[model samples]
Target: MAVRGAGRVRSEVLSKKLYCASSTPPPHARHFADNQCQSMESFFTRFKNVLVLVAILLAQTIGLAVQVRRPVESGAPDSSKVTLIRYWAVSVVSPFERFFHGIGYTFRHGWSNYVDLRHTRQENHDLQDQIARLRLEQASFAEDAMQGHRLQAMLDFQQHYVSTTVAAQVIGTSGNDLSRVIYIDKGSKDGLKTDQAVITPDGIVGKIRDVFPHTSQVLLINDQTSGAGVLLATTRIRAILRGSTTGQILINNLTPDNRIKPGEQVLSSGGDQVYPRGLAVGTIESIKIDPDHQPYTLIQLRPAANLNQLEEVLVITGTQTTLSAQAQKDLAAGVTTAEAQAAAKQIADQQAAEAAARSAAQIVADRLPSIHEGEDEAKPGTAAPPATTPPVSVVPKPLPTIHSDRYSPGATPSASDLKPGAAEPPNEKDLN
Candidate 1:
């Protein structure tokens, strides 16, 4: 399975790559290196001289406070000593002295405020980045929650149908971590056998190629050798969906004039041992008629499960045969839990179950509109989706009209390189 890497961080530094010779100097000069310091010192000294005079006068007040705090002799007791202490400590130039201190304090506070403002601006920039990251995370979590609903649909297959099913999340994928495999949470211990079908909420993914005690690797439907019987949902035209080496499907035997068109749904026809029926393969991208004169028309299928970005998938324990969700509900109507007395409770429970299912279905319908062939806008003037598009299902898109042997995870094996006039397996989308 491929290991996804975190996106690389972009450098915020505005580097213009200014290359210069040794003789070249910098654009900006140092502020304090000039005679500014001399001027400041001269100013400070002048201010200090004024402060010294103020200090000489104000010493009386400090002197009195000090005397009170610690009684002291006036050195040489003069007649003006007590009077000087009284006048200076109480009123002599006290207002001017306060004014001086206030100016000095204001300067200090102003410098500190500027520093604080710079720091706050940097912090705000960081906080903006944090908010953007948090929004991305919130969207991811919300998507995961919405995906929980889709999983509920996959899990619904486990419930309505009487098949032993185990759930698993796709922990990793391939390419960066290059391999044509998907790593799943389930393993041999969880009844995940080698070659067991792995799928998702939408439909079939692939089979377990290898299994460990707690983890298993899935051979994606995009695998060259992977093959499953598939039919168009709209046309019900049966065709063999096989994996391309390029990780798409070479839907062969589909004529250009056939009912299948781009965007038509594909599902497992369920003939071979690979996957069960009704497992959605993907939508048709284009219809083609190869001039090579093959028995059937050529079809290119996009996988239902996104094989490359295998973030999550489900592993089917046994074969699943579904008429439809609606069909199953209709079928269960006659089957009562008990006899006449318990009938009311059984009906209530069934109704409640149906209501819950409808509600769950409603959430999807509200978020996802049905897509028909080649229509751009979901409806006429529906708001464009938010900048962030949801993670596409592990599904791959259709291929162009080339020799359909494409979408392979790795190099095409020598045996799969069939030339013209050679009988090859009909569009091995996932030829098991």
Candidate 2:
């Protein structure tokens, strides 16, 4: 009876376990499960926005990283890797920019013409006065230049001659104050190259930083990375000119002991190999000792070219080496060929005049009355006798020589022989 009861209990337990495993849940448990599912769906729906924002930020960060990363060897940014976005943007927007530029140009052109016509008479008068002044200055400069040419010839100095240039219109600027760069309507197609000089009649503006197919960037002298070899126009002290973060240009590498004055002109030294020697750079504004960097004086400069307001510029496409041989031949005798010819003619004329003078003087001497050397002298109260025939040979009278015995070793000479009339020394005031 006990075994039969245990078998019945096991069968009942198996049946309950099977039924519980297969049976559906009660209403409260089903509700709880449904609520948890709804919460998960809602949480994921909110997280979608966060994920989108993260994706955008991540993309921007990557782009920025690409832009900032550069080849470690050279500080210069690899131009080949320069963002094509800039080129595409330029290509798309260039037509609009050019249209606006054209409009501005037309208005400016008309207004300028009207104003020019209005001021023509006054301008002409002013120009005449300016021409007069320039003429006077030019005459002085011509003389000075002639003298300089002579001196240069003597020193065998040569000058670099600009062989070719292409005119370019200033189209726009980089619009970044830190860069201080400008763009022109010229590029590689126009023979523009990186590091070529840009200038105007007034002074040097800058140099080509980057060249594109149809445009180029010119870095002004006030950019921090820009440097130039410069010379003090007055002192001729060579130094490196650099730009500072403060937007000021400075003549650097000068010792603290160096003397610098305000308003002293600065010029390109050509040591940097961009600008030709003697191009105008700027003028000194102030000088002070740098406390942070000892033994160096800080010199501030005001650029000669108005870099901020550039409208037109000249691109130096090429240069020719000045042949020393030509200059050597042309500058012979420190004068121009025409001047040398004139000088030669004048010297020849002077020689001819001197020869004529000597011949005339000889003829007059020959015409004078001849007197024999041995003829007796007439008495003071009697008439003088005239010479009839010339002597066979005329001998000059011998000069009297005083022997050393005339003055004994210890004896002092007479006053007539020792004393001479004192003449005033020549005045050097005129020469000075």
Candidate 3:
């Protein structure tokens, strides 16, 4: 009975321990379990994005492996064979990529078209300015070219005239309408003297009236005090060119018998000892009856040189004296004589050579065979006619001699002078 009581007590004790363990835990054990659950939740929160990235990487890696293992056929990919992973990836990423690309493209377009156009406009304006400057330079160059052409013409005229000239620039002018005078930047120091002719490439301008040390005064042909001896080029009528009180150039001492007409050219006659002969003076402008002198005709002339617009001129100191002195020197040195003799000798030699050639040609023509009538139609078997030879003692007839006094150079010979049987008369070229 005591053992049974003890067993009941132990069983009741074990039941109490089981109930405590199962239902209400100890404080230390419960605290450790709650801490483990909190730590697990914190770990998940800290690495949530990392875990998601790892999962995506794993999925892509599996897709790549599948793609690599699959056998690819040649040519276009079959839509049926395309994997869902690539399709989904392209679909999900395409919209954002396209959106960003469009934004970038629009931004670049605006920058290139709208923003950069400001600089382009400035460059265009600068280019226009440069073109304008170039056009101005071109105009300046054209003006220089025209000046060069004028200078060239003057140089050619100087060479043709073959006169000693001093180039002078027109510096000033006498401001009186009646006294048309100009001052030149040349003087006695430059070999300019009174009465020296002044001229341009176009025609004669005037003559020097007074000479200073470094400058000279010129009296233009239109001045009232100026006078020049002029002659009509076609009619050869001599007249005096004098300026009127009104600064009009008039031809005086022209009689009514003188048939002067407009447009006739006038040239210097060198009578006044101021201008050289053959220099262009003026042209006849009009012809009318003189009211003051009814017996004489009034003649108006237009000066050749542009007197009002004179810029450059040539002063002829002395062309005739210089040329005459040169000619005298050449003659004294026997240069002219030698040149004439040499030219004559050359001409004589050429004539002699031509005569010899003519003589030889005549002998050759006489030696050639001559055909008689019916020679072409003669049969081959028939004997040819015998050629008759003149007697060797029969001398040819002699030609008549021409008298030196009667033979005029370059005159054609008369038929009466040529004998019928004599050789042909000497040609005019042979006589020369």
Candidate 4:
């Protein structure tokens, strides 16, 4: 009976405990527990990303604080104590930066090479053009230098004829036979004027017909309308040298009585005032008489200037006299033109008479009798003189003697004191 009671009580106790444990909780407590679980899960779900960020920030803050504390104690960090943060940042970001930087550098370097090549090609082309231009300039400079030398020589030679002159280049020509003219690279701006006489070192070339600021047209002497006052050099006869329609130069206005021959030289007469006197005009080529003109002779001439191949020429701006101013002053003292001419004629006549006397003397000397061989054998210094009388008795008229200026007053001769058929007085050679 005791054991049964004990077992029953235990059973009852167990029932009670089981009943109590298994019984449903109060509504408020169950509600509270359910509410708390939901609240905790929602909180964790909603703030999980924020919680991770907070943790990372807290870790970085701690590391920064530690790094900052070390710098404060050491005043400043040395290379050995360099912060790990800097190295870590660089390690993480440097690869990306290096890759991007390498790409940028490659692009820039290639673009630079491309631009440099383009510039080099352009520069080479420009340099080639400049070289060509410089070569042409060098050629022109050489030509100008040569022309200057020739012009300088001409200036020196023509100092008396040319007072002053401007150098010019023959640039062009009138291309037609009707108008024989050339264009010079000089003009009014350079002091060139119309009708200015153009010449060369050889002879007169032409006259300026038109003038411009930078150029002038020169009418050549060979033109049909051109004429120059000329004189026959040998005969001293005045004539007009005109270019014919056929481009032939002829000396007209010469009377039939005027003696003109081929090869006679012609000279400028200065009558036209275009050319100074004594400039060579031409040489006569041929002569013919015009029956219709009754008295004028037609004389052809070869112009002195090489008109076909003219290069450099001179424009005679003015004339310079060969005679000095002092010479003219002295010449005007006692000498009249007529008296001077008369004196020249007397001197010419005296010279002619002396020439004739010399001729007679030579003839007499040639005809003299030869001495015997015995005379040739005589001693060189002791030979006997030859006979004065020759086979021919040639009479040589006495020549008028010119006295020096100091002896002129006392050396004058008179015809009344002259003897006829007089011979030279004997000298020591005649008596030998």
- Best TM-score among the predictions, by candidate number: 2
For model 4, how does the per-residue alpha-carbon lDDT over 1-432 read when each residue is reduced to its tens digit? 999999998996676455444545687686665556557656866899999999999998986675565324211222323434434543454455446645766786898776657678788899999976765555445445445546867777442445666767666676678878776767778898777788887778878876655667788877886888888899898988777667778876887654667999998888887877778888989888866575778888888889887767889787774434553343443244335555788999999998788777767755553434344446668755585553344433233336333234334345566578875444433466
lDDT of the candidates, in the order given: 0.60, 0.73, 0.70, 0.68
Where does model 2 exceed 4 Å of error?
A: 1-77, 83-85, 143-158, 323-432
**What ranking emerges by lDDT with the best candidate at the front?**
2, 3, 4, 1
Give the alpha carbon lDDT tens digit for every residue of 235-257 in model 3: 99888888777877888688775
Order the candidates by TM-score, highest first — what do you get?
Answer: 2, 3, 4, 1
Better of 1 and 2 by TM-score: 2
Candidate 3: global Cα-lDDT?
Answer: 0.70
Q: Candidate 4: deviation at residue 10, Å? A: 99
Query: Candidate 3 clash total?
Result: 0
For all candidates, what are the clash counts?
35, 0, 0, 1
Error of 4 at 179 (Å): 1.1
Report how far off residue 303 is in candidate 4 (Å): 0.7
Per-candidate Cα RMSD to the true structure, in Å, reads 41.4, 19.1, 43.1, 40.7
Candidate 2 least-lDDT 10 residues: 70-79
Query: What tens digits encode model 1's per-residue C-alpha lDDT throughout 170-279?
Result: 55544332236656666777888876777777778887766656666577777665677787898877887766657777787665664557899988877666676667
TM-score of 2: 0.59
Estimate the TM-score for candidate 4: 0.38
